[model samples]
Target chain A: MKNLTIPEEELMLPGHTACLGCGATLAMRYALKALGKNTIVTIPACCWAVIPGVYPARTLEVPLLYTAFEVTGAAISGIKNALEATGNDDINVLGFAGDGGTADIGIQSLSGAVERGENVFYIMYDNEAYMNTGVQRSSSTPKGAWTTTTQVGKVRDWKKEKKKNMVEIMVAHNIPYAATASIAFPEDLIKKLEKGKNIKGPKFYHIYATCPTGWRISPSKTVEIARLAVESKVFPLYEVDHGVYNITYMPKKNVSVKEYMLPQGRFRHLTEDEIKEIQSEVDKDWNLLLEKEKWTQSLNKVQ
Target chain B: MKKMLTGNYASAYGAKVSKVKVVSAYPITPQTTIVEKIAEFIANGEFDGKYIRVESEHSAMASCIAAENTGVRTFTATSSHGLALMHEMLHWASGARLPIVMSVVNRSLGPPWSIWSDQQDTISQRDTGWMQIYTENNQEVLDSIIMAYRIAENEIVMLPAMVIEDAFILSHTMEPVDIPDQADVDEFLPDYNPKFKLDVSEPMGFGSLIMPEGPFMEFKYKGHESMNNALKIIDETDILFKKKFGRSYGGTVETYKLDNAKYALVMMGSTASTGKEVVDKMRDEGYEVGLLRIRSFRPFPKDKLRNYLSNMKSIGVFDRSYTFGYGGAVFSEVRNTMYGKNIPIKGYIGGLGGRDVTMNLIEKIFLDVVNMSEKGQDKDYEWVGLNGDKRWSQ
Candidate 1:
């Protein structure tokens, strides 16, 4: 992409406790670069909550307020208002949470924060399952994935429900900004985070962070798996700003969903029929997303 | 200006005079009108603040903690289930030492839901490290909200406070409440300007894991000491409030004719208002009975209670909410405080689940305590107004 430009400043300390090739860790690293030192981050219960280590030994250079599992959005709104009240309006407030904390247990508070039009940035690092809880099934777990709760035994159930569409769910609130990003594409992720920070009202970002420990993939292959997810259109790279849909990156040719799933042990047991079904579902989503962007652009043109 | 207001409106006016910077709350029974009145105040330009309409009680408390940490005064209100839902975060707010003030309209917990008055909702939150203040009437509700901020925000006592009132009983019942001047409240509370906040210029992280053996134990040690410190601050604030507004709730525990009485009945919240009425009625009939109303419950008023009970030969505790398999909460605290004093005490658990606690019921409890031949030292509690209780049944 013509010499990708990332800022030189490193906001994450080198001795953090995150696993090797951990996508959420990298996501936090890149996020701090975009947000810089003038940021206050509130983390709900997630991998990052523990990754920062104990009180006096935090890795983040910025101020962080660790909150209860479901209060990230509410905490962000509070921090933002607090800043305004105390005459520190220039600093940014960001809420960082895991998939279980965001798409599942935290959805109501998140929805309330956005509906109230609070000025804050919410980043949901989607690891698909409740990884920190030892890989239990969360609403963000993709279909045909094997989590502890979604065991592939007896009835052969492996998360039959589809992964919750958190981006669309957030957009339904008509917030100023909602975007889908991935750790594989740091430039796009960073750009979107910067854009979100610039927006005055509530902004949400759903970043596809790969979990090697939870998904039973090689730790080194975490970013590769994240890349495959975007290439296969299973986790698209897109942004919706002020009701305007825009797909920022489009792959030249879609690799099948099998190419995305085969390396991960969580999806290893899927049969050819199941792979085809997943492929069809991915194709359906891609087509709908394109149609939405086109219709939104045309509507803008007419108006 | 004196206006007739429910306990809910009194709470709102109290927050208004204090100039709370942020208010976040969710609507539940008995608490809905509190937030409604606050919203009305904010809409009419009476209170200039950021009002967040949170989804649930959990979010409500979460937002208040956040706002409070930012070094601004914050307020919220909730009822039975809402307070229960906020239980986990309530620890965080107090643990982080945020001076957030909340009003709990005390409704009974459910099986078959009832919105009427009971003390369980706030009593359930007693152990959450928050300074708990139970108000007896609309005026106390209004005054306590302001004094709660003054007491809680005192540098030595930077813990959260809850000004609790009974659902429907005080929350819905109307009375004449004196609305104080904003300038006087400003002199009492000042602006909530803390020394630290969530600022990038001076970065600080809260809710960090501190090992108990290390500073974590010290953190709790300080928290407990701060709760103890709040007792003096509460008293001083009460004194100053009297000088400014010409009304003072006898701090910690307000007493009614307890100096000469041989028997006393102890209670808190709106039930104490009923006890006051009954104590007056009993005294009219040449009975030397008294009423000891507990105002600040978390610090437990150990010294004040001992002083009040020192002369009394017997005392009865009227608990509107039971402690389940144990005696009443106030009764348990009383026994714990008077462990060696050997004051004959009887605890009557009644008015649970919003059952009416009439004046006759309270009189019966006092009479029973005065007539008893046994010395205090009972593990069992007397359930008042039970189906076949002869003392209260007739």
Candidate 2:
């Protein structure tokens, strides 16, 4: 028998209301499988809020707590602390929020929880835009993405700002474990979550979730696009463990940014010159991450 | 044991005795000391609970809701701006049917920035499905918290509660409070064991989305029914607490000298203390005046209020918070309660923004109600104790 890397248990059932090929739904499935049934997930107002069927019917097998849009961090902290108070400290408290809820409105509460060193997992599923609210521009929306609020029209006013680095934000709080994962790699995503489940204190994961409807791509292309994001270095797969950085995976072949951006309609309007600029920016960021890993490892060796 | 404790410390000690398992709070003026004292108790190993020093009041209330959802007693405290910030979660707590208790140190809201006593902070949250109890002194502040948990955690009344203390007047003022014994409190107010909770062994979803055809309205109606059901529970808890500790702040509404009185003065919170003294003075002078203090505001005690004010020729409802377009918040509700009683209920707006509700002001209100009972109807309401040239006497 082959060694199974991913768990077989179906914690997130099939009757969800997620859009076809929704990467966020798959991310949740992998997360629940990794954390097992002894988990309580507190979801803020996001795609998952509706994905789990309305009252009387639910998709996740684990206990779920739905909180207000900006209060996921606080809710998880409360649950974890209360569980500890009751002498039942083995259960996992998970906070799952979308990009808009995390990178913008919920940042203060999330930062507070991380700084307080609450024992929980805060996973932010990034779909680039506010997919649940119909592709409105969020802080996590990448540069030059054509969201509803950031239209690529007569004046070429796409998203002018760069994507917010959520993992970096968690790392800035000096969290015990902070990592970036993609829906395409379930084994890697599940591994990080299972590892974080053992370590005490706050662990944050920034998962790349593709939205076919919001990005104007085919429903079947969700995992493919997510793979492209990681392979082309638009979103790197790396973990920062207590100031020590380790890149989890490196692409076997050098994939260009043009290959990643060409598929989705959100970035189809990017001119040749704009594509070149994005390529250079991605290369620069990847190199900075490399230097950080090398320098931190050298410092660790000396100590 | 009797201890000289501020209302804030009284609140902390109340939670300590109640054996609250989780306390999440933020630091706001007049409310900071309550959590600070709780922190001290936790540091000294006096209180066995988990304290989350949250970043903001919104998070504080949110954490309280989550903790209570896990089927444990939870508490929090905040003043004006912090209470306002926690407005959304206040509704969330009650809507989720989590019996979370909080101490709201009532202070005036800003735009003018005052940190003094007023009912506006808690008054604004009247419709948020929370059982609000106004306390007169440090003793009531402590006792109400212990009572609030019992009443709120009742099987029929699964609602959150606010034990409101006037900022500076009660929150900062020191008074001798008899702290109940831990064994006595444990017997009186039992541990919170929720019927349904967020548990790993019993997996269920809470606060999920309900479609329009679903039970959203039904859930809200259940909350309303639970609030009305809490009136009986509040009285029962008060009686039980009195049996255990030999102290009780007359359930819902406390009355003084209302028997065979021609006119009545209505009030809430600390101002009622002044009203009590004024009632005594008027009684000695052979004036037919009495004082009716509303202890529970959310479950308005409508029937009890109407029963007390039925025989009075006229009634004066004093409010520290106004409704802007109309009279006071309590005045409107009192009038609604006595809709066709033919009693001339006049509104007296006073003590706003920490302006003192002095004995003279209470005397003025009683005199006005008495004078109005004899003379014909005049203005429906007037702002008492204003600092302008012309006084309310005119």
Candidate 3:
């Protein structure tokens, strides 16, 4: 309820070509509120590429560069360099791309940018599937999701592999800032973005944006489902700073993972046993993350 | 003031005098010296810019693209494999129209992994929408870079430019280059003024999504028109550069001793130097053989090339890069230009992957062209410098 006080200033204008109740659109709205007007966004080929509308008329109030699907990292690095060169260090260079762009196609350039310690913020809006290219399964797509490429039937099945651990990947790079945010929690998402903006060197924000179009979910229940994801530990809110883990928000009451999945038709084929298996997976991941936070804290104490 | 300098130092000196704001690069052979000099310049405080030492060629290109989009005059250098690695961002930089200038030390792409001189790398990127210029010597390398900014940043042609030079042949071989004074360069190239920038004061959208058909076509059409217009700007800028610096070489194609020549040899890159030597030697011996050096690759200078070759008895094309299934890359383009015309054309696939195109090789190529013109029997394609054993084996 406290997060409802986010500034109502319309940084992203209406009449843009986003689908009805697009969670990614809301994510952009809130992100701009935190990053403010002094941000330059570099977007690779993704859904946001279409959402921003056509040239001479875009939804964003900030300067944006639409780069190749694989070069968002490089594009943002270039923008940051340009900013610094012109004595405009106050501006933030934000790389906004979808999970497919970040976790798959754009990974090499992203890794290179981060490894070089580029002074910029990279935000991967994870809606799971490659929504722009007609719901293909990206590496970030959760296991057991029925995508166009990962169809479920006899002899063939949904994605068998678990979603990639991008946060851990960012941690491996020892970036200055890396965090997981959810559109369901505006306060937490804005807080992470604002904090990321202040830190020097490469920072990453993996925001869980619900995709009603791709995920086969009700547009009206976008935020509600996104909230259930975090509450159920299906997508936990956490941050990693210089290899130290910090769980940003703890759910007041733990809910069954089924409560999060049952609402989405994308997961309708899962049996009760399969749902339980997914729950166990989420629990195991959350516990491992908790251990990492505790271990990092203890290391701080020893130091 | 003009000083004779090698092409490699000219590239370095061009970046130096341009007061480039950011330099991001990873070193590869041939291109390593360019960035090395840039790093030294930064260390010596000759240029005040952020020198980002990135891990790979990909990051180097990406960093500079970001830097340039944010309204900085960013500079980067690479060659061969390094250039290939930056392939994706090459499209991004030009499509975003960032006006980023890069110096490509030309080297052959690898399968056998040779780090010798050739034009394959830069030639392979001709479709990336960047204005590409080939430099003959140090002066052209220096002057083209300064002029590249003018051409790329033009309101009509706001695309990136790649100033390419032969790898070790030019990059490592230093000649006495007359370094332009900072003041003179300052007068020549003003501070880079971006038309639309990522600024806080006035927020705007750039490189945003263009829908399925309409927006994509519009952007592509504009890109095509801009590149077409760049032909005139390239020549105009060359004229301005000559007036200011008192020197000019092939604005599009450099013609040497074609006055009364019946047969002409056409080539690009460092091999053109050898071609010129052979042309002069043939001229001394009263042979009607001349040389034409193609300086600009993009905007292909089709008209200029056609006009130059129309009256020639026979035109010989020497290409350093291949088109794989097709014949030589430059040879195909020349044939396309000569299509519907009566000009006789002969193609020689030589100097590929850094093979030395010596004066003797030039003489042999010229002889073939002359033989083709006299006998009316044109050889489809011939590989130069291969020994009899190797030639038979292939």
Q: How well does candidate 1 reproduce the true complex, by DockQ?
A: 0.74
lDDT per residue (tens digit) for residues A1-303 in model 2: 989999999999989999999999999999998999989999999999999998889999988999998998899999999999989999999999999999999998999999999999999999988888899999999998999999988999999789999988898899999999999999999999999987899999999999999999999999999999999999999999888999999886688999999999999899999999999999999999999999998998998
Looking at candidate 1, what is the lDDT of residue B338? 79
> Each candidate's iRMS in angstroms?
1.1, 0.6, 1.9
User: What TM-score would chain A of each candidate receive against the reference chain A?
Assistant: 0.98, 0.99, 0.96
| lDDT (tens digit, per residue) of candidate 1 on A1-303 | 587567779888888888777899988999999889989999988898889887688898888888999999899989888778667788888899999999889999999999999989999999999888799999999999999999999889888888999989988999999999889999998899888867899989999999999999999899899999999999989999888899999976658899999999999889999989988999999999999999998998998
Query: Model 2, range B1-394, lDDT digits (tens) per residue?
Result: 9999999999999999999999999999989899899999999999999999989999999999898998899999998999999999999999999989999999999879899889999999988999999999999999999999999988899999999999988888899999988888888888899899998998999989998996999999999999999988888888887888888888999998898889998899999988889999989999989889999998989989888889989999999998888899899899999999988999989898898788877887888899898896688887888876255532
lDDT of 3 by residue, B327-354 (tens): 6878888889889887678777767677
Model with the higher TM-score, candidate 2 or 3: 2
Question: Which prediction has the highest lDDT against the true structure?
Answer: 2
Q: How accurate is chain B of model 1, given as a TM-score from 0 to 1? A: 0.97
Model 1 chain B lowest lDDT segment of ten: B372-381
TM-score on 0 to 1 scale for chain A of candidate 2: 0.99
As for TM-score, the candidate ahead, 1 or 2, is 2
Stretches off by above 4 angstroms in model 3 are A1-5, B1-7, B211-218, B389-394
By DockQ: ranked, best first: 2, 1, 3
lDDT of 1 by residue, B77-177 (tens): 99999999999999999999999999989999987888878888888889999999999899999999999999988999999999998888899989998
User: Which one is best on DockQ?
Assistant: 2
